[model samples]
Target: MLKEALAFKRPLIFADSFFVNKPERVEMILFLMSLCLLVYNLDQRELRNSLKRAKTGVKSQICKLTDYHTLRFI
Candidate 1:
């Protein structure tokens, strides 16, 4: 993902260097901003999934511990 983002950005940076006009620069800036936002959203989604998996693992462990304790009492 990082590599892809860098690939997308490199051409735009090169283009910006050649184009000095206001409108084109504005368009390029907007494109870069949107690209950054997209990358950020993808990162956030990955983080959320990881946290969810961790939560599920912890819950299962707790359930197993509780079941073991209950069985011991019986």
Candidate 2:
């Protein structure tokens, strides 16, 4: 549903509540969406590993927050 809209170059404004409530699903969807965008732009790679991780379906179901965050210090 959302993917279809985004695929057609339509504007998308996902509410924070959506991701907040379904962190894992949201991340998985985001990763898949990125793959679609990559294919559309003709820049794709084998992200099978990441895809596998997403299938676990157990993320921030309790707190409605992302389970992890990373920072790069350079």
Highest lDDT: give the candidate number: 1
What is the clash tally of candidate 2? 0
Q: Model 1 TM-score? A: 0.46
Per-residue error for 59 in candidate 2, Å, reads 48
lDDT of 2 by residue, 1-74 (tens): 34643554434544443434577887887898788665743321223334356653223436443423211100
lDDT of 2: 0.45
- What are the Cα lDDT values of the candidates? 0.52, 0.45
TM-scores of all candidate predictions against the true structure: 0.46, 0.32
- Residue lDDT tens for model 1, 18-37: 54559877888879778866
Model 2: how large is the Cα RMSD against the reference?
15.4
